[model samples]
Target: MTREESDMIDHRRLGRELDLFVSDPLAGAGLPIWLPAGAAARHAVEEYVRDLERRAGYQHVYSPPLGKRELFALSGHLGYFADDMFPPLRLSADDEFVLRPALCPHQLVYRARGRSYRELPLRIAELGGMYRAERSGVLGGLSRVRAISLNDAHNFCALDQVGEEVREILRLIREAHAALGVRPAGFRLSLRGPGEKYVGDDAQWARAEELLRAALDGVDFTEAPGEAAFYGPKIDIQIVDAAGRESTLSTVQLDFDKPERFDLSYTDASGARRRPVMVHRSLVGSMERLFAYLIEVHQGAFPPWYAPVQLVLLPVDAGQAGAAAELARRAVAAGLRAEVDAGGSLGARIRDAAHRRVPYVGVVGAREAADGSVSLRLRDGRSVAPMPVADALGLVGAVVAARSTDLLPAAA
Candidate 1:
């Protein structure tokens, strides 16, 4: 589609029409509020990512969004990364607490205590909040937000285990992209460029770059000097927007600087203390940017699994209201998102459902209701013959469970 065509279906328009999110001036620029529908979808994605990390052996933790100014100083944010950070909130002359711009500092503190080789690969993950002081002119919808809820993680591993840990993170990124229907524009090896202010020395940078290169063995990527994080190099997964603009959607970075700065150490096999490497990675980036891309690419018809309302039951008249309500209750009991809309005419309700981008709409007439069945109407304009309510719900559940991109099960 042309850029104009894509722009017309941008997330800003779809978000308004679908009630996904809203940005009000009183709430300040760049801080968008998630409405109910958007909140439900975001919650689903958050649950999926947390579970994915847990199954991958990551221990989740909660961290505050504010920290002492000294914390960022230790993380090198004050030195090389102050432009994007908000001004420090001075509680007193010596007790300033600033909103965090990154989670690495907090993660490093988590590993501050003594550790052994057995915990070499301590994978810590969080779906937490951070704030960036983005310029007002750059703030638009959910794409560029001041407050970001990030899906961030940090892995502290021994030097020998860095290669495998980075590669495994790449695997997780690919799986998440497939499940979320994210089409990567390209992959990038972000590195330090000439005259750029960076934390590590030449030897450390070279070693980090080499490790990242080795990890991208079978993958196609381009070198993007000057795009790497202040501390080290990263593998950035890029996504194109409705305007054909490309931005990072996920990433895996190699960091040797943080461990040294934080003095993180682990006991080696020979009873010697050793420094561990910190690997920073985000499987799906931030929720705001993710939804921005998802809204535009899918045109608000999100995949069934993450769609706000999976099924809407429309009863033909008052007689079948009971039947529609019963099916909706059953769908909820089955851990599916469902609702009954009996306020409008059959045709009107169907059109409304289509406008809302509902995945499945079950139309209940007298005969179908009497049989405890429903004629399923899909969002793609396909209609199924009247089937048992249980069977209809099963089809949806199957697609959701498989995280299939298709609205229907593969066999169907």
Candidate 2:
């Protein structure tokens, strides 16, 4: 595909062309329908990140989509993020509930249930669908949406352990980005300024900002005063898209105020109770935004692990269909997402695979049938020497498993 064609295969176009997903104008606009392909992509992303989170010692937790209005009120969202919250849903029991705009408060309440200093640093993660109110103008495709599937998590750590936890989370984020091939550039430290725009005691804000700054001392960052959240300062990872737009991809925030507001405490080693510092971190942010950004960044050519179909088996004609199906089955059994493309001419089949951004294409024909071998083509049209079906599948599997795009020959 030419540069023009690549650009045209961006998020919006790919979402429509591949039938991966669609935003319905009639179904309250911002909500999107995840067709099979889109859902598969989301599922792959979730599984990948969930595995990483588990290895990083994060326990998975589930929370309700809506909670009492006072939940956010205690978390300070009612004052700071009221504009982004959905209006309260009045219950028949004469109570008020609002769709959760964030997952922090529910997790905090869970942490507050009871714990000793032995559980000093509790890491919990959730892949939650959260809703927030947004005006029609700001709602675009997945890039900017009112509803989001967030990879939200928080760590409640004793004050002394905060720095090491931040560093470990940063490493995890880097590993996740490396897997997706979208490594972040650097951090943006959001700090507080003296103003009525923020809440909380001035001394707490200063102390919290200083702690975060110290944590980020050696890291690269652009400090932005007056951009801090009302509860605390934060470090947002920023990335530049293919369209050259700079966006915050993920964040790690340090908060000293919420524990006080919620009256949270944990027993210390000295047998005394103490307030634990809270860190809110989301490596991929919302899946919705990340998918949109990745589509644009890679121009719809996803990496091997993330691609819907990593390989496709193309038969020369109906005569070779049986062998092609066998190869497809083998590819699937090898843990690769694959299918047989038995329609159209050889050139057309290869072109289709290229357009779909598949990493490998295996062509089976009479020669391969007779010799029990198959011709392999890197999604680029260059012909790889004919190899036994097992060998070809093994090579492709290795490439996918290692996420080594270099193993794929350049486009022809």
Candidate 3:
């Protein structure tokens, strides 16, 4: 690869340049601290995902990051995934806890309570924080981390409802990715092969695999044997970034063994007790990984809605500082992220903001102040001169509200 191309894909360097996040030796390897800008972007993503989940009938819940050792044992992680998990912490001779490596076990516990047939297809969502024992050698920037903020959810549905639930989960994944301007290259139908590592019996596995395949009937996918999770078959959505590197960003897994292991049941229409099938879904697997993907894909030019600093107000001179400050306040009041850069030279400030990939740069000068407007410069090199304050607010507010990836309208 050329030097510029390689540099664009190096998220570590981009993260530093954008001041998105930081990693320190004091905090240990594989753990990243999100600075203010990164945190703002993450919060925006979380809010957007939550809104999507809400519209899809998902009920959000908060689960603890750590669980008792026995909890994972009951979920079969002790047998199948012990190496990937952090070592258990011993509280007492009989009491031990471990940080959760996945949110599925706790979600299973949540559905273990009495449930009725009407509640079948119950979707529970969380922006769960999980910890895994990732090897230090394999740790990278945000792409791979010990602590992960997962956009995870689980759907408990009846046997006959599994296909429809999986389809809905897949739809959710596509919609969410599209909103973020990320496109899935294809889907992988990951299934277990001949192995003792898989949890369920052959019959159960066959049924689950069949149902998953049926759900992807018209959709294109490749069968990847041995790539399935120990507990279930899954659809791994692969995305190729602009740099031509591929990664799995979203997944819809059909888990049948966990509910049975946990003895989770719901009363059926005939008043018969039946185990509910669990569907594990992650739209943007983890916020950190998604952020890294976006940084590389867009080359740090985040869309206006997702940009940490959507707009930067630059005063042409010190005399225009008051006008710039007032405009910043107005933008903030309109629910836009704006900041005033009145310190450096006007040209230097504009260049700095552009380098940081701010979506819109507003230059405020005496003429602009007197005209009650600002000269807007877009990231795409399009300049809209003398835009009225009200018009600018309306334009930006609409883009932010609509979550448009394009900075300017088509007509522009």
Candidate 4:
């Protein structure tokens, strides 16, 4: 790649310029502190995904970041994933705890309570924090972090409902990625074979694999033997970023062992107790990694809905500052993120906004302020004709409401 192209896709540099996040040596590696701008963007993403999950009939929940040692032990995490977990904290001889490395165990606990056949295919979701003990050498920007915020969920369903549940999960995955303008290059049908590390008997594993395969019929995916999780088979969504780097961004796994391990069951319509199958899935995977991917893919220029500051009103002189501030207030009231840039000269302020990759910039001078209009400037080097304040607001409001990726819809 050319130097310019290489620099454009460098998330670390762009993150600094955009004031997104920061990592400190004293604070330890792989732990990034999100600045105000970064936090705003993160909030936007979280809200968007939660809305999607809600529409998909998933009930959201908040789980603690730490769990008792016995919880992980019961979930088989200690046996299969202990290497990536932080050391347990011993509060007392009998009360040892460890930071949660995944959300599955806590979710399993939630499902262990009494449930009925009417609640079959119960979907529970959480955008909660998880901790991992990563090697210092592998720590890099947000892509690889010790503290991760996962968009995780689990579906508890009857055996006869597994196929439909998987299909619905896959649909949600596709819709979410499409909304964010991310295209999955392919899928990996991860399975287990000849591995003593896996849980469940051979017949059980074989049945689960067969169910997953049948669910994935008509979908294009590559079979990957031995890539399955210790307890289940999964479909991993592979993403290719603008820099041509490949990463797995989403996953859906079918698990039969965890429910039995936790002794979870629900009463069937026939009045018989039965073990419910569990499906562990992450629609967007790690928020940190997804944010990093977005930064690189869009080159720090986020869409209107996701941009921290959707529009910046630049007052040409101190006399017009009131007008700019009032405009910003109106924009915010209309459900758009807007800011007034009254610092430095007009040229400097414009350049600063451009450098920060703000989607829209409005230059308000005395004449335009008196006329109740704005000279709108888009990120691309194109300027719209001076338009009435109401019209400009309507245009931007439409874009924000639609969550359109197109910055210059007028031009388009």
Q: Compose the digit string of candidate 1's lDDT tens values, residues 137-236.
A: 9988999999999999999899899999999999999999899999999999999987758888999999999999999999999999899998999999
Best first by TM-score, ranked: 1, 3, 4, 2
Which digits, one per residue and each the tens of the lDDT, describe model 2 over residues 1-412? 4567556846778778766689877877789878776787678789989989998889998889888888888877888889999899998676899898888878754454777889868888999978889898887778778888999888989989988898888888888888777767678999887777677787877777777777777788898888787788888898765555577888899888777887878989798989988899998989888988777777667777778887888888898899889888888888889999987799998888887777778888899977878887775556789999888887777777766545452431
Off by over 4 Å in 2: 1-10, 183-185, 407-412
Q: Is candidate 1 or candidate 2 better by lDDT?
A: 1
Instruction: For model 2, state the Cα shift of residue 131 in Å.
Output: 1.3
- Clashing pairs for model 4 are none
- For model 4, the superposed segments whose C-alpha errors exceed 4 Å read 2-4, 241-243, 408-412
Those runs of model 3 whose alpha carbons end farther than 4 Å from true positions after fitting are: 1-4, 241-245, 410-412
Name the candidate that leads on TM-score: 1
After TM-score superposition, the amount by which residue 148's alpha carbon in candidate 2 deviates from its true location, in angstroms, is 0.5
Error of 4 at 384 (Å): 2.1
User: How high a TM-score does candidate 3 get?
Assistant: 0.97
Per-candidate alpha-carbon RMSD to the true structure: 1.0, 2.9, 1.5, 1.7
lDDT of each: 0.93, 0.81, 0.88, 0.89
Model 2 reaches what TM-score against the true structure?
A: 0.92
**TM-score, every prediction:** 0.98, 0.92, 0.97, 0.96
Backbone clashes, candidate 4:
0
